[model samples]
Target: VERRSASFALRMVVHIVGDVHQPLHAADGVDANHPGGDIGGNARRFLPDCNATNLHALWDSGGGRYSLHWVSTKPEWEAMRAALLRDARQMVQNRTAVAAMDPLRFASALETATWEEAVEALSMSGGFGLVRQMIGESAGIAESEVFVGLQMNPHSFGGPLPCPDAAYFANAASVSTQRIIVGGYRLSFFLRHIAARLRRQGLLVQGGDNVFFGVTNAWEAAPNAALH
Candidate 1:
């Protein structure tokens, strides 16, 4: 692939992996109200007073704490970047507190997996096993945490949707935070794996201290370098 295409592919992988870490992304509600499915909770509305319009939006925004809006200006983008960095620092600092909330023990597995073990697993399963495990974990969380306390309206429309209590919001925030951290870790692993594969395939070359992937200049000099 061309340099730009490879970069875009990597970004898509990162984005999709991060999204899959969210419980709602891997699960949907199916009940008498809507037999087809809740479309990952998008069909179920939350109370008007809630920060999000629907169940999926609530978790997507990190329980209203990390709602993101368009940044049209450079200053706005800078501010958002700083805020994200701050939040990431805080999450890393308090990651241990959220460990108990991760029933799948992904953090532990990531920590213990050696390079050889990871490569072996990836080779054997073509990385599908890891992806499946992550999805399964998210689905389990969606069932036990996201869908457990929800009170569905008897009628699909014309009535106020059930409002999640403060406790639910708090728990959701914690779970979201944990998932974000896990997603970051997983993304890092995936990028490293991709880089290794590219190097092995002669698609990436080591230039000084930086690895250039099918590109002449340093990858850091690329316009989208800030994403890293």
Candidate 2:
């Protein structure tokens, strides 16, 4: 294995863990199988009038929208981000497919969320063992490469420097920033809201406060971007 820089490796490891946590990423399904055209979350329509597009895209980008200019202070946003980060960290540390699958399915539907239901769901014990295992194996390789790269170059690839030209990086950086702000936690909130709203419709948040898709492959039945 190549030698990698510690900082570079840490970030890569963090990202790799997140990627594997997403059930869709673990899926080997055929895109053509979905009735919706695969627009990467842009094709399918979700409710709430806020985001009415593809599921994958919402999961990928919706986290940023939650903290939009709607809030006046960055502190509020940071607080929410911190809480989310904590929940995410817990999810990674104690991931359980069975415990997570129920809420995962509920969230996948894009329904409304409520604290009452969230509290109830958090009491179950489906578990994150499989999630932890996969993350451990996959994230390691990615981090090694990232750290090794850092060792080879003092200037980070995205860091300011004799790195890539600014124009070359502009679009990529913008998108990356967008994901950090609008993805993950934000998306989780939106879906939880949707689930709470649709609770009357036979949808319920399962497990204990976790909402990961494919926690048990139930949401795998939902429409995909390619299906649009």
Candidate 3:
């Protein structure tokens, strides 16, 4: 299984690490009334300047493009990446305190939601263990944290319906940025651990420069609720 070791594992990690950082990608709109969940906010609709139309769609585009559209070309991606890097730089400066936050602690807090989803068995070992934990945290954020005090349906409806304004989009973007930062920190947690093990085996995984960074906290202990 040498082919499935190290390099392959690293590739998979890269793909999924970006995913877990996306608040909406990891979330599900849920409540006491409809305990079954809103299928990751697909059940809700809103207008976010662009025509993407749903709550999930807005986040799927990274919330920077309020005018709902996809990043389909290299040029578009480059522009978006530049904006993101700037935001990330500023975020790092502003939240220098986030360095103390623990990804493992956050993972456990998110796992509290797994019992609600009845996935404890699947969350048993290896990749399933991490997936279960990450997705649980994602759902935890989706179920309550992202809504920002707005009213949403507690029952079976898709939304309270977003009659959104400028402030709403701004808050959405802010939340998205925070989540993305946390995602990078979490990715580092895995690689750094792997590096420690590799060092024991007389190997090293090297990257360039002083590219090290930190993390922010998971949602505050508000009964483990979240929204997308």
Candidate 4:
């Protein structure tokens, strides 16, 4: 039960960490049309011609390439997984995309460091500081990139805004792809840090060719033990 709970918690943490790296998740557009705030652009609707109905949805979907859809069957799941892996590989292989995030410098540093070293490298903030820095960076991108050419009118009779131009879509796609790579790397850093701590506490063990979490030397004696 403890192992299952730990696995669930880790999955939630990874999901949330990836979400915060999305610029729209960290910012709300505020203009005369929405002095109260744009509710992260959800209040600002785009024309029907646009890929998404609102600015928030546009950024969330990466201009429709990442739009949400249901996948219930095993085959559907497998297909989605394969598509995701292919896209990830393609992004990693793209020199411009990988260079934008500097994965070699940022991800490699934390990924290679011990837990104590990571804490020291973060100036003792223990990863929270790094998460906050990521949020700030996303907010900056939201302002400069996401909200730059938005045309919000205060008196449009609740009508939708104009569809973003091709340039806007292009930039959004570029930024979203880079942020996705960075977020994945950041999540890896956190997982590696947690694994290091678990190893220190003897809750994780090096076995053959695998690192097993939520287990100790006598893990084989326990049934239904988590493997990671």
List where candidate 2 sits over 4 angstroms from the true fold.
1-4, 28-52, 60-73, 85-228
Q: List the residue pairs that clash in candidate 4.
A: none
Number of backbone collisions per candidate: 0, 44, 10, 0
What tens digits encode model 1's per-residue C-alpha lDDT throughout 116-228?
76655534456556777788888988999998776786444635477888888899988777678766655555556576666666666645433344333212222122122
Error of 4 at 214 (Å): 14
Q: Sorted on lDDT, highest at the top, how do the candidates line up? A: 1, 4, 3, 2
lDDT of 2 at 58: 34
- What would the TM-score be for candidate 3 when compared with the true structure? 0.56
Per-residue CA lDDT of model 3 for 1-228, tens digit only, reads 232365566556555765765666776656663378666666666545444466676676555453344387999978865665555555455333444454445344333343423233334544566556667777677655566654465233434464445566677767666666666545544544444444465444344331111211212211011111
Q: List the global CA lDDT of all models.
A: 0.67, 0.34, 0.51, 0.65
Query: Each model's TM-score?
Result: 0.75, 0.29, 0.56, 0.75
TM-score quality measure for candidate 1:
0.75
Query: Model 2, 1-228: lDDT tens per residue?
Result: 112232244335335434543333333222333344223323333334433133343334322223223355888867865655553443334223422533234343233435554434432334443334444433342233211211122143322212322332343334333223223332343333434444554434355433322312222211111111
lDDT of 2 at 224: 19
Q: lDDT for model 4, please.
A: 0.65
Best by lDDT: 1
Error of 3 at 1 (Å): 4.2
Candidate 4 residue spans exceeding 4 A from truth = 93-100, 103-112, 117-128, 154-158, 199-228
